[model samples]
Target chain A: MKYHILIAFFLLLTNLNKGFAGGGEGHGQAFDPAGTAIHHISDGNVYTILDGIGVTLPLPVIVYVPEKGWDMFSSGHFHPGHHEDGHHAYNGFVLHHGSIYRVTDPTFPAEGSVEVQGFEHELENNGGKDKDVYYVNFNGTKYRLDARSTLDGGVLGGGITSFYDFSITKNVVSMILVSLFLLWLFISAANAYKKNPNKAPKGIQNVIEPMVLFIRDEVAVPFIGKKYPIFLPFLLSVFFFILGLNLWGQIPFLGSVNVTGSLSVTMVLAVLVFIIVNVNGNKHYWGHIFWMPGVPGPIKILLAFVEVMGLFIKPLTLMLRLAGNISAGHIAILSFIGLIFIFGKSGESLGGSVVGSVVSVPLTMFMMAIEVIVAFVQAFVFTILTASFIGAATEEHHHDHEHEHGHGHA
Target chain B: MTGTLAALGAGLAVIGAGLGIGMVGGKAMEAIARQPEASGDIRSGMIIMAAFIEGAALIAILLSILMA
Candidate 1:
C-alpha cells in the first residue's frame, strides 16, 4: 500500500511535467519555464486532458464581430491543419492563443515566423500597456500574424479590432461545478437536520455543523456582536466556497482548473464584499466615514476623503491577495518541476535531471502539503475579515465606553 | 538583466513579508506568555494584522511581475 502510494505520487509529478512540456513542440523532451508555468496557471480555451497523447476537450468558441455579425463554432475549428477539417477558421476569424482574430493575409507564415516575431516587438513598442497575450482585442488593425496569434507564426495583414467574446472558459466551468457542489453539500446537510430533530448530529451534519458554529462564534459573534445571525449565512457560504475551491485545485487531475487563482473570480468575490459592506452599512457607519462626531471641521473633511478611499482600497486588497497567493502557489510548483528539465538540458546529461528531480520533487511535495494548510487558512482569514468589515459597518458606536475611559484621564 | 531585476524585486517582497510576519509572531508570543488568558483574542488580532502585511507584499509582487 505504501509503495503504491509512492508510485502514484511519482507518476503525478511526472505527468505534471509532461502535461506542461507538451504545450509546445518537442513534447516532454524540452521545457520553457516561464511559458510552461504561466500556461498551467492561466485559463485556456481548450481543456487539455492529455497533451502528450494529443487528447484535448475543445470548449465552444463564441465571438461577435461588427462586420461578421456573429461567429460561433467549436474551439477545435481553431486547430492548425487538422486531417478532418483542413483549416480552422470561421468567417475569416481565426483562434490564436485562446483569442479570436480576423486574418486578411491569405499566405501568412505559419505561427512562429520571423516576421511575426518582429511584429510582436513592434506591438510591444507601440503600446506599453500590459496586453493579454492570449486574449488580444481585435481592433480592425493589420497585425503581423505572429503578433496576432501565438499559434500561427504567420502575420495578419489587417483585421477587425473590436469583437465581444463571451465564451465559457475552463474557469467558468470550474466555477459552475463549485457552485453546484456547495449547493448539494449544504442542502443535504440542512435536510439531515430537518429529518431528525437534533439527536446528536449525524453524518454530514456532524461535519458541517461545527464549521458553521466556528464561523458564527469565532468569526461572526466576536466581531459582529448582536447582529451576528444576520450575516452568518453569507460568511458561511464565502468560507466554505473558497475552502472547497482551494482544496479542489489540489486534487491530482483537477490541479489545472484552480478557479480561485483566476483574477476575475477573486474580483467578483471582493465585489460581493464591497457591495454588502456599503449596502448594509448603518447610519453610524456612514456618519463615521463622511463626518466624524468628535473631529474638527477641517480635519473631518480630510479624514472623510481618506475613509472613502479606504472603502475601495479594502476590496482591491482582498481581490489581489487571494488571486496572488493561489496563482503564486501553482506557479511555484510548476517552476520547481521546470527545474528538472532546466538542469537536464543545461549540462546535456541525465545526472542533472536525476539530481534535480531528487531535490525538486521532494520540495514540490512539501510545498503541496503546505498548500493544503494554506487552503484552510486563506478561507479562514477571508471569512474573518469579511465579518470584521461588516461588523464595523453595522456596529453602533458606544459613547459610554469613551465616557468610562475618560474617567481615567480625569 | 531584466530577469535578474525581477528576481530581485520578488525576493525583496518576500523579505518584507517575512519580516512583517516575524514581528507579528514574536509580539503575539510575548503577549501570550505575559497574559495567557487573552491569548485567543491576541492571536486572532495578530492574524488579521499579518494578513494586511501579506496583502501589501502580494500587491508589490504582482506589480513587479507586471513591470518585468
Candidate 2:
C-alpha cells in the first residue's frame, strides 16, 4: 500500500511538471528542430547529455602537424558554448567541426586566450555592423570563427584547416566502449565454458551459447559449408558489434553516438568484408569472373566487365544501406520530437505545443520500438549477406557426370 | 521547395519498397505453410530478399537527401 501511494504521488508530480511546461506562453524563439536533429546524429567532439541544460562532456583532441610535430589537448579548449569556460586556442591549434586547425595570423588569439564571441566586423565584406571574429590560418589561407563555428569571411573565402586530426570524438569514444564490453562478455563466456567443459551452460554462457550456435547452424553451415569454421568468427563479431552499437544508440541519457550511421564507419566495415571475401575466393570464383568457359568471346567480355564491377558495387551498397537505415531512424524520431516546438511557433500559444507533444510523444515511442527491431534485423542481414558472399567465393564446382562420360566412351 | 521535392522522392521510394517487401513476406508465408519443417530456411531467404529491396529504397532516399 505504501509503495502504491509513492508511485501514484510520483506520477502526479510528473503530470504537474508537464502541465507547467506547457502552460508557458509565446516568449522565446522556436527551437530549430533540423539543427538539433543534425547535431544529435552527426559526429561531434563533445557528447551532449542534455541540450537544454547545456551539459556536455568534451573529448580529447589529438592532431599532428608536419611542422609542429604533435599537439594533444582536451576538446574543452574549443569552448562548447558561451556559458562554458575554456580557452579557444591551444598550442596555436583550434577545434572546428570536430577537427583541429592551426592559426597563423599574428593578430589572432594566442594559446590560452579568451574566446571572442561573434563574427569580426573588419573582415565582414557586406555593408553592416562588424561582427566579432577570430582568425585562424590553415596552410596559406585565412579563416574566421564566430560563436558557433568557423565562418567563411577570410582571405581564402571559406573555413580551412591544415592539421591532421586524430581526435577521439564522441563516436570514437562510444566505439571503444562497445568494443571493451564485447571483449568482456565473450571472454567471460569462454572462461565459463572452459571451467565446465562437459556440463550444460549457465548464466551468460547459456545466453550467448545459443546465439553462437544460431550463427553457426543457420548462417555458417548452410552458407559456407565445409569452410564454415574459417568465417564463423568474423560473422559472429560483425553481427554482435552492429547489434551492440545499435542498441547502445537507443539509450536516452548516454547521448548515444550513432556509430553505424556514420558513413566512414560503415565504409570501413564493408571494406573489411570485401577484403575477406576476395582473399578467401577459390579458383572457380576467379574463373567465373574473368573468363567464362562455355560462353562466346563477345558475351564473355561483357560478363567479365559486369563481374568486376559487381565487386566494388557490393561493398559500396553495404556501406550505404547500413548508414542510411540507421540515420533515417534517428531523423524520424527527432523530427517527431521537433513537432511540438513547430506547433508552438504556428499557433503562437502554449496550447498548440501541448497538443503537438501529446500527439507526437506516443508516435515517437512507437518509432523507437520499431528501431529496436530494425537494429536486430540489420545486424542479421549484414551477417547473412557476408556469409553468402563467402560461400559463393569458395564453392567448388563438381563434374561427376564427366567421369561417367569417360566410362561410356570406353 | 527543394526539400519538399526531396521528401516526395523519399515517399515514393518507401512505397516501392513496401510493395516489394510485402510480396517477399507473402511468398515466404506461403512456402512455410506448404512445408512447415523448412520454415527456418524459407524465413532466412525471405529476409535476404527483403533486405535487398530495402537497400534499393534506402539508396534512393539517400540520393534525394544529398541532392537537396
Candidate 3:
C-alpha cells in the first residue's frame, strides 16, 4: 500500500519535472486553464426549425474555435426537448453522425449579450454588431470564446474552468482530495509495515494486499521477468492511480467528473508507459519488432517499419480507448436525463414522461453500478496490457512450450 | 419512440452478458474449490474465457447502442 503512495510521490516529481523542464505546454497542460484541455470550443450552432418533423434539430459543424466557451452556441448542442413549463427549456438539436449541435445561446436575448444571424451567431445578436461573444462564469472568472468544429460536421468543445464551487465545478478540489487521500493511504500503509513488515497485511492492507500481490505475481512477473521488482513500483502506481481516479470518478458528483477523460491526463499516462517500456525493453524484444525471426528479408524490413510505428500507435490506441469509453458513458447517462424534455416538447402528452422518467431512474442507477466494474476492469486492462507490452518487447514469443510451462513465471 | 425499448434491450443484453460471465467465473471458482492445486491453470483459462465473453457482450452493447 505504501508502494501506491510512492506513485503519488512520482506523480509529484513528474509534475515538478514538467514544471521545470518546459513549463506547462501541449499535452502536459490538461488541468492548465491556458490551453485546450477540458475546455473545448464547439462548432455547429443550434436552430429551432419548426418545419421538419415537428422537432427542432441541433446541427453541428466540425471547425476550430479560439475559445471553449463558444461551444455553448453551436447548433449541435441545441437541447430540443429542454423546455419545462414556463421555465426556459430547450427546443432544438439532433444527433447527426453521433454528435450534438444547436443554435448556441438561442434564448439569451439579453441586450448586452451576443445575438444570432439566420444561421450564425454574430454582431446582430449583440445590439447591431457581429461576432459578439458570450462569457461562461467559472468559479467567478468569466471565459470568453467562439464556436469551432471539424470539417466533417463535429463541434470540438474544449476549455474548462475550475472556478465553480469546490465540490461542484472545481476539478482542483477533487484532485486535492485525491492527493490528500493518497497521502493518508500511504502513511497508513507505511505505518502498518513499520509495525510489522510481514504480518499478512491487516485493515486496508487486507484489501489492497491481494491486489498489489496480484499485479506483481500475475501481471508484472510473467511479462517483465526478473526485472519485475524494478517495474513493480511503476505498475502498482498506475493500477492504483487509475483505480483511485476511477473510483473517485464514480463518487456521485465526483464520479460524474472527468479527470482521466482529459486528453492531457491520458497523454501523460501514455507517455509514462512509453518511457518505461522503451527504457526497460530487453534486446531480443526490440530485435523481434525490428527484425522478424523467420520471414523473408524484404518482408522483415517492411514489418520492422510497421513494428516501430506500433510503439506509438499502441499507446495512442490505449489512451483514446480509455478516454473515449469513459467519456461516452458519462455523456450517455446525462443525455438520458435530458430525454424527459424531448417527450414533453414533442407533444407526446404527459403519459410518456412516466415511463421515460421512471425508467431512466433504474437505467441510470444500473449505469452507475456498471461504471464501478468498468472502472476496475479498465484499470486492470490498462495495467495488464502495459505489462504485456513490456513483456513482449523484452521477451520473444514462445510457441513451442508457451503453455506447457505457462504458469511458471519467466 | 423505440429508443426506450432499445435501451431496455441494451440493459437486458448487458445483464445477460454479465450473467454469462458470472457463470463462467463461478464455475471456475467451483472447479478451483474442487481442485485447489489446479487453481492457477483453471484461473488462466477462466480469465481468457471471461475476456472473450466480455468482448462479446461489449460488442453486443455497442451494436445495441449504434442501433438504438
Candidate 4:
C-alpha cells in the first residue's frame, strides 16, 4: 500500500512538471524566474488545472464601468491562450495574464467580441515613478488598457480606473471549495459523534478530534479562561479555515491556488478578528487602552497611545505574517523549479536540463515537506496570537493587585 | 541601485530574524531539558516568540520590496 501511494505521488509530481512546462512555453525569450514566480502566486480569473493538457476552468467576470454600466460574461470569452493571454476580447475587455483590462481608446469595439492581435507591456514614467502600462493590439492599432480599479487611490499604482472587477476569481473559488469541504468533513464527524456517542472516534473524527481538543485544551482554555467556550467556535473556524486553505494551496495538480498567500484575503481575516476582539473587549480592556489604572498621569497618556497603536499593529501583523509566510513558501518552491530552466539555458542543453532536474527535484521535495509543517505552524500561530489577544482584551481585573505586586518585586 | 539596496535590506532583516529565532529555539531546548514534563508549554511559547520576531522581519522585508 505504501509503495502504491509513493508511485501515485511520483505520478502527481510528473504531472506538476508538465503543467509548469506548458505555462513556460516561451520560444526564445529568456526564462524570467521572478516574473514567473509572481504570476504563479497572483490570483487569476481562469483556473488552469493542467496547462499541458489545456484544461482551464472558466470563471464568471463581473465588471462595472462608471458610465458604461454593468457587464457580465464568462472569462472563457477571452479564449485564454498561452500564458493566459486572451486570443479575443469580449466587449472591449481583454484578459491579460488572467486579469481583465479595458481598452480605453474609442476606436476599439464597445459592444461585441473582437479578435485581439496581441498585448504589449511598456514601462512608462507616471508622475516621476516608472509604471507598467499595458496595451492591447486590435486592427494594427495599440490601445492602452486600463486595469480594474483598486481602493488604494493610486498609492499602490492602482487607482480609480475604467472598470471595477467584481468577478469570481481563482482565490474566491478556492475559498469556497475549501469551506465546502470543511463543512462536509465537520458535519460528517459531528454526525458520527451523535450516532455513536458511546463508541470510540473513527476515520475523520479521529483526524479532527485531536486538533479540536488541542486547540480547546492548549490554546482556548489557557488563554481565554472560563470564557473559552464562547470563543471556541470562532477560534476553531479561524484555525481550520486557515489550515484548509494552506493545505489546498500545497496540492500539486489543483491549480496551486494561492488563496491564503493573497494579502486581500488575509486582510479580511484580520479585520474579522479585529472586529470580534474589539466588540468582545470588556471594561478592563477599554480602560487599559484609554487610561491605565496604575500608571503615572504623563506615562498613562504615552502608554495609551502605545496601546492603541498595539491594537492596530496586532491585526496588521496577523495579516502580514500569514500572507508573507505562505507567499514566501510558494515563491521558494517556484524558484527551485526555475533552477531547471536556468541551468538548461531555456532548454538548449539536454545535459544541463538533466542535472537541473536532478538537483531541483530533491530540493523542491524538501521545500514541500517544510511547507507542510509551515501550513500547520502558521495556522497554529495565527490562532494562538488571536487567542492571546482575546485573553488580554477579556481579562478580569481581579488579578490587578497581584500583577502590581509582581511588578513591584521585579 | 534601489534594487540592490532593497536586497541588502531584506537580507539584513532575515539575518536579524534568524538570530532571534535561533536564540528562542536554543533557550526553549534548554528549558525543555531542565523540565521534560513542561516541554509542551515551552515549545508553544518558543514558537509564539519566534513568530513575533518573524513578524517584525516580515514587515521589514515587505517595506523593502515596496521600496524597490
Candidate 5:
C-alpha cells in the first residue's frame, strides 16, 4: 500500500510538471496564475486531459449566425495547436483559448478551412468601459472576432455578438456523462430491489438506500410534511445530481470540468427552483407575501414589499452560494498547484521547483479532501434549502391562534 | 488601484463569513454537547444557517471579482 501510494504521488508530480510546461510554452509570457486558474475553471470547446502529453478529446462545434445560418462540424477540424488555439479557421470560425470566435471582417473567407496566423488580445474602449477585444490574424490581415453571444446583457461583460455557440462544450459533456452514470446506477439499484423483493439489500442497492432514506427522513419529512412524497423525487434528483457533478469535478485528470462552478449552470438550477416554488405556493403563501393578516394597512404594504424582495433574493442567493463555493475550491486548489511554477520562476530554478513541490503536494492533497466534504455539504445545502422553500410555500397556516395565545402569554 | 481595492473587498467579505460560520459552528458544538442525542438535527440546522451566511458573503465576493 505504501509503495503504491508513493508511486501514485510520483506520477502525479511528473504529470503536474508537464502540465505546467505545456501551459507556459507557447505564450512566451510570464506565468499568470489568475489567468491560468480562470482558464482551467471556465468551460472549453475541447477537452484537454494533459496538455503537455498532447492528449485532447475533441467536442462538436455548433454555431449559428444571422447571415450564415447554422454550421455544425467537429472541433478537430481546427487542428487545435498550443493552448487549444486553432491552427486553421473552419468556415470563418476560429477556436482560440478553447472557445469559438467568428471572424467579422468581410474579406475573411466564409467557407472552407484556411490557415490562420494566430489570435491577439487588445483592450478596446466601447462607450465608457474598456473591453478585452480579440482579433484573429489571417493572411497577414487582422480581422476582429466576435465572441459567442451570452444572455447576460453585458452585465458580465458578455452581450449579443455576431453568432451563438450551441456547442457540446466540456461542461455539457460532463453533465451528460454524469447524468448517464446516475441513470445507470439508480436503474440497476431499482432492478436489484425488484428482483430481491423483500430480501436483504445488497450490492448497489445498499449503497443508494441509505442516502435516499436520509433525505426522505431528515429533509423531506421534517420540512415538507405530509406532502413529502410529492416532492421527494424532485428533492432526491436535485441532491444526487449536484452530488454527482461535484464528485465528478473533483476527479483529477478528467479535464477538471467545473459544471456547478459555472454561474450559468447554477443560474439555470436556481431559476428552476424559483419557478417550482412559486408555482406550488398555496393561498397562504401568497397571502403572507402580498398582505400579512392582522397587520396595520401601511405596515402590511411595507412588509409586502420586503417579502417580494425576499422571494427573488432567496433563489439569487442559492445560485451564488453553490457556484461561489465550488469555484473558490477549484481556484484554491489551482493556486496551490501554481505555487510550483511561481516559486520555480517558471522552471528557471530546479531547486525552487523541488521546494515548491514539497510544500504544494500536501496542501493540494488537503484541499482535495476538504473539497470532497464541500461537495457533500453544498449538495445537501441546496437540497435542504429547496425543501425548506417548498415547505414554506405549501405549509398550511395555523399561526393565527398561536399568535394570539403567544400574545396573551406575553 | 482598483484591483487592490477589489482584493481588499473580497478579504473583508471572507472575514465576515469566517466570523459568522465560526459562531455557528461553536454554538452548534455547544448545543450538541449539551444534548448529544440531538446532534443530527442540530448539525443539519447549523449547516443550513451557515449556508445562508455564506450566501451573503459569496455575493459580496462575486461583486468584488466583477469589479476587478
Candidate 6:
C-alpha cells in the first residue's frame, strides 16, 4: 500500500510539472523527450510535403494521410494542423496566401525527362529566391517539384515529393550500404568456418573460433549439459543476429531504428527466447515451477503462483530493457542537437548552441563507444539467460547427490 | 518532463545493470584464468545471473521507451 501511494504521488508530481514540455514530447528525439522550445515542427529536422516540382509555392498547410505505406518503426512526416474530427486531413497541399492545391493522378517520372525552369527557389532548396517552376524525372514522366513566391514576397512550400515513392532516402541509401557490409562480413565468417573444419584455424577462423568455443562451452555446455552441442548453433545465432542489428543501428545514416529501442521489436525477440527456453526445457523444470521438489504441500501451492508469474516477468523485462536503452540513447542525442534551435530564438541562443553542441560532442561519442559494447553485451546476456532458463527446467529439481547423502551424513 | 524523466531513469537503470554484469564478467574471466577447465561451469552461471540483472535494466528501458 505504501509503495502504491508513493508511485501515485510520483505520478501526480510528474503530471503537474509537465507544463514546460513541447507537444512532441517523448517522440524519441533523444536529448529532450519533450518537444524542444527552439525547434518547432516548421524546422527542417523533419521533411515536409511538396505540392509540385520545386520546393516553392508555399503550402502553409499540407495534410498527411497515414497512408497504407506508413512505417511505424520510423520517425515519419506529418503536417502541423488538425481538423475538428481529429484527422490530419489536408487537401493534397494547400498553398500559402489562401490558395489550396490538389494532388494529381499517379505518375512516376523517369530519368532526365522533366525540364528544369531556370533559377527559382524551392522551399527545400535554400538555393536562391527566384520564381521558377522546375521539372524532374524519376522513371520516365516529367514531374514538377518547386516552390513559388506568393504575391506578398513570402516563400511557399519547399518540398519535392513523388507520387509513387517508397525506397528512397539519404539515410536509407547508407543503410543499404551498411547492410551489404554486414552481409559480406557474415558470409566471410561462414566461408571461413566451412573451409577450415580441421587443421589449425587460419586468420578469421582464429578470431571467430574462440568466441564460438566460448559460447559453446560457457553458455551451452553447463546449462544444457550433455546435449549442449545441439543448442550451440542457436546460442551463437542469437548473439550474432542481435549484435548485427545493434551494430547496424550505429551506422552513420543507415544505422537507424533503435531496434534495441523499439519495445514491440524487443518484446517479440524476448517472447521468442521465452518460447525457445520453455519448449526445450526438461520435465523437471516445469515440475519445479509448478509442483516443487521438497516443499510442504501447502507452501508448494503458494510457490506455484509465484513461479508461473516469474516466467512472464523475466522475458517481459528482457524485451523492455534492450528496446528502452537503445531508443533512449537516440532520443537523447537528437534532443541535445535540438536545444540549439530552441535556444536559437532567444538572446541566450548563442550560449545555448555552443554549450549544447560542445557538451554533446564528447558525451555522445563516449556513449557511442559504450553503445557498441552494450550491443554485444546485451546479446550475450540474453542468450545466456535463455540457456540458463532452459537448463534449469531440464536439470533435476533436486540434487541427486543430496538425496543419496541424506541429511549431511557423508 | 515525464518523457525526460523516463529517459533519465532508464539510463540510470541500465548503468546499474551494466555495473553488475561487468563485475560478474570480470570475476568469471578471473576465475577462468586460475582454473581453465572450470571456466565452462563458471561462465554459464555468471551469464544467467548477468542476464537477470540485465532484465531489470531492460524493463526500465522498455517502459521509458513506451512512455516516450
Top model number, DockQ: 5
User: How much is A329 displaced in model 4, in angstroms?
Assistant: 0.6
Query: Once superposed on the true structure, which residue ranges of model 2 sit more than 4 Å away at CA?
Result: A1-29, A82-106, A118-161, A346-350, A400-410, B1-8
lDDT of 1 by residue, A247-357 (tens): 877775553576798777898899999999889898878877888667689998988888887888788888888888888788887788777767666335466766667
Better of 5 and 6 by lDDT: 5
Q: In model 1, where do residues sit more than 4 Å from their true spots?
A: A1-16, A22-30, A50-54, A79-87, A91-123, A127-161, A346-351, A401-410, B1-10
Off by over 4 Å in 3: A1-144, A147-173, A197-200, A344-354, A396-410, B1-68
RMSD of each: 6.7, 7.6, 16.0, 3.4, 3.2, 16.2
Question: Candidate 2, residue A217: CA error in Å?
Answer: 0.9
| Candidate 6 Cα deviation (angstroms), residue A170 | 12
DockQ pick, better of 2 and 5: 5
Chain B TM-score of candidate 3 stands at 0.84
Where does candidate 5 clash, by residue pair?
Answer: none
Q: Lowest lDDT 10-mer window, candidate 4 chain B?
A: B43-52
- fnat, candidate 3? 0.00
lDDT of 2 by residue, A49-141 (tens): 644355768888777666567767887767755222233656665654334446655666555644533221133533332333455443434
Higher-DockQ candidate of 1 and 2:
1
lDDT of 1 by residue, B26-60 (tens): 99999999999999899889988888888778877
Q: TM-scores of all models?
A: 0.81, 0.80, 0.54, 0.93, 0.94, 0.56
| lDDT on C-alpha atoms for all candidate structures | 0.68, 0.71, 0.52, 0.85, 0.86, 0.51
Ranking by TM-score: 5, 4, 1, 2, 6, 3
lDDT of 4 at A27: 39
Score candidate 5 by lDDT: 0.86
lDDT of 3 by residue, A92-187 (tens): 222221123232443433222232221211233323222333333323333332322323231122223211111112233345677688778877
Which ten contiguous residues of candidate 5 chain A have the minimum total lDDT?
A401-410
Report how far off residue A29 is in candidate 4 (Å). Answer: 1.2
DockQ of each: 0.54, 0.51, 0.10, 0.60, 0.61, 0.37
Candidate 6 per-residue lDDT, tens place, B8-65, comes to 9888987898899999999999999999989767866676667668777766665675
- Model 1's DockQ score: 0.54
lDDT of 2: 0.71
